[model samples]
Target: MSRIPPIKITPIKLIIPAMFALTLFPVFYKIEAQDLKLPQCQDEEIVNTVVDFFISESVWSAYGESKIKEMINSSIHTANLTLKNSCVPMRRQSGKLYQVDMTIQAFDPDLASYRNQLLRVTEPTIIKEITQKPNHYYALVVDDLPDDILGKTDVYLDPQFLILSDQAEKYTLEHELGHLANAWHDDTSWNSSLSKYLEEYTPDAHKNELHAYARGYNCAGRRTIMSQSSVYYLQLPIYSSPDIFFGDETCGDHEHADNARQLREYARRLKDKMKNNV
Candidate 1:
């Protein structure tokens, strides 16, 4: 009590700080909601493509398959898209399934490390022999993977195979297939030109739109299934006009056309290489 001088409480300081926080809270909350919003299906073709993918799968469990079908039906109803019966052949026939031994030192820590080491140590000749056909796809579904990795594809391997974690999304299979098709990431140096074009030429009609078409790479104007940075579908529509296409001319003024071209070229080159070896 001897030193109980005036406890000078700065009322103005307390009031100012409280007012500032109240003023900013609503703005911060609104921004966070917008950022956290999940992407919604917008294009009819994209919705149908997703449906077709689920229908084409032959390896999913009965329950898993039913869930995918249910999702497709719900998306269709929500988007008001006409459903069709068409289905393309599954690009990969079921091959020998390998359960990655997560406990092994060869696969310890993370699947990415294991994948890299596996590719490095394993011979292409051995893989080709084991696979029988050099162009047959293989499947490797692991029970778990490092928390950050959903799925991965080794395009360097002939008839590329995908390694997926159990928790991966239904669409992850299609995403890895994009890698198998030799489609580079939308932001990778391989697609830099297209990325630039997307940034500069986003149309007024599409301005402020949040369609799947506008969430790829840093471009934020074109979406592709190959994009590691966007919410996209497996639909690949070719366009004849810039009015419809979202990327640069290297993409043939069409969505997914460049990826298609790359796959064809890769197939041709691989075929030639194999023939020469024989």
Candidate 2:
């Protein structure tokens, strides 16, 4: 098994490589264009956001409401910081920032009163009933998720609703939010191009491809939060970006992926749509 590099940081020039390779991996990233009833992205210079999280009775019982709120808030803070570091134009040129405040409340009044258990749910109606706006997000924190799932997002929704398992890792919210921002996984092509690359180049590269995916390495082999989750975890709150480099490794345009750029585009598109609506 090839040794996984230890987490390290060495400053390098910020230069985001072009994503021409994205066209080759449309299966992993493209969504068909169609009319969507979900909330649209706003055309705003600044994003002042509030995310509401509903705590299930069972989860609240296991970990008090305060603890749950703290964890979620911390995750959001990390996400904001990652955006600040990875996407410079949001703060420097545009004077825009991604700041999200949070509210934690009881999941359901009836469920809270009787300590009723809420099952794992993916039904659109249930989420729609609770999701009030397309500009903001609503997350339902439940007691459990499948062994393989830490959290899941309703991608079809405009402002997505996230179903987070109580046992999810600290940065799981960040990873899910990346999905909401249209950021594809850094390791999304493991079965396709990545496997082929490994076969041609480093056939003995990694013993576990899933772990490799989860590492979400940029060209320099630094971990990015948006990669698929594996036993190897996100050591730093970083996203792959064309504008920032966390280390010394250099990569060609074809080898790069830029989640940070996608986030910037998401905000821009939302701002444009909001302007048209106005």
Candidate 3:
């Protein structure tokens, strides 16, 4: 992602052996080309199989199960965070489930509302399998991935998260769930608007990116969940450590977290509106 100047600090050089240990041989962080897809699975039995894939992929390891539940909860169960003017009522397509497609789709207002309820009103729903498609935004688990690469979304899958196993769990799901959050990415002209931040930093340098993200958006460096404060405190790019943060030199401080307060405010507004609607 770093296309601008070289990093000022000594770059974190990884020895070849260390890189291999982290599975960096096939770096998934390569600049992505076009979106890609998996074999489509829309049939009921096929979808069930996909669900099984998710359970198998997620349950064995503590990290897998915990991450999956957290993702599902935050994605649909949490309160809304969009502006009031944009809020809408949740509708239920009872017994209807959108099959996983390889393609990405903008959030349906009704679906967004219903998903909120699914997260808040109803118990968390778990799919043993998933139906996949191209040109769609979806998530499912598979045996094909390595443990470090346990989680995958198209935004997180075909490209970035598949190889960057260390951060894959959150980034993969956050990238996909960001879509559900009314967050924007990909071809909505974010490249020109946001790419500069990624461009200005060093490869894997994370500080300034966190400061620049507005609501309803997600990306590599500083994003709402995956890119930001993870359960493990990936330090990522914005904050120096779990407890310490750079004061005002947000854009420069690799550990700065300028917008967190504003972000919380926005999230509260959205949550209240959604609750009222429900």
Candidate 4:
């Protein structure tokens, strides 16, 4: 070949950029799942579970290779650690299973991953269309969710915050899932009649700042997976029997069962809810 200029590295590098100007090959770098960080949760093993009862291979596949890898990377980078002033747990009576209709569209590659996850997770449950009859077994998801929620429950995301913000994403995902899983606020119904001191100190409007500590402490002890101290793995796992099935296992052990501090925190929430009229 006529003097093939010694492999021109600089020119070669420019060639791709130059080519992109004329050609349309949407190129993107591959993101590795290892790059992300997840904190060592209270119960590490339980937190890592992706059991058949929960998200299985089929479900994982739907997350799309790139997106799944990205979510993992983000987690790795941030190291899913606990945030102070963060915790949410609600209580709802046990009932028959219900289906949730979570129809969401992806506006970006990352957003798409979360939407896909929602579609996949609810697969085992019946997806019924909107009709006149009331549906105890299904829910209607109307919008796209944020990133941390990628493998978790999907919910309407607020525009004020970035979907990828670890704190926001995790909190939002857990809160919505609380509703999806039918968990109610530990507030339950407060006994308005209870001494102003009791209501004021509890997680109630009647409660004043003095009891705020007490309110939160009691809420911590209810022992539901939905407790404020839970990590993704500790949240509700899929119950295999059927959509409507609820048994002994349906109830989840406290994610922080070993952590006496968190357990006491939960107790406050529980007490407030059990308060008559509370």
Instruction: For each candidate in the order shown, give its overall lDDT on alpha carbons.
Output: 0.34, 0.45, 0.26, 0.25
lDDT of 3 by residue, 1-278 (tens): 32222112111221110000121111223222122111221222110001111122223243543454444443232222111111222210111122111111224322233222222322233321112211122233333344444333322112111112223432343333332322332123434645664565324533332333332212233222323222222222211112222232122212232223233333454445445644
Candidate 2 residue 78 C-alpha distance from true site, Å: 0.9
Q: Give the backbone clash total of model 2.
A: 6
Poorest 10 consecutive residues by lDDT, candidate 4: 14-23
Q: State TM-scores per candidate.
A: 0.42, 0.56, 0.28, 0.22
Per-prediction CA RMSD (Å): 21.2, 17.1, 19.8, 20.5
Query: Given candidate 3, what's the lDDT at residue 214?
Result: 33
* Ranking according to lDDT, highest score first: 2, 1, 3, 4
The candidate that wins on lDDT is 2
For each of the candidates, give the backbone clash count. Answer: 0, 6, 28, 46
Kindly indicate the candidate among 3 and 4 with the higher TM-score.
3
Worst 10 residues of 1 by lDDT: 16-25
For model 1, give the RMSD to the true fold.
21.2
- Model 1: residue 73 alpha-carbon error in angstroms: 17
Overlapping backbone residue pairs in candidate 4 total 46
Where does candidate 2 stray beyond 4 Å?
A: 1-44, 88-132, 157-159, 188-216, 219-221, 229-234, 250-256, 276-278
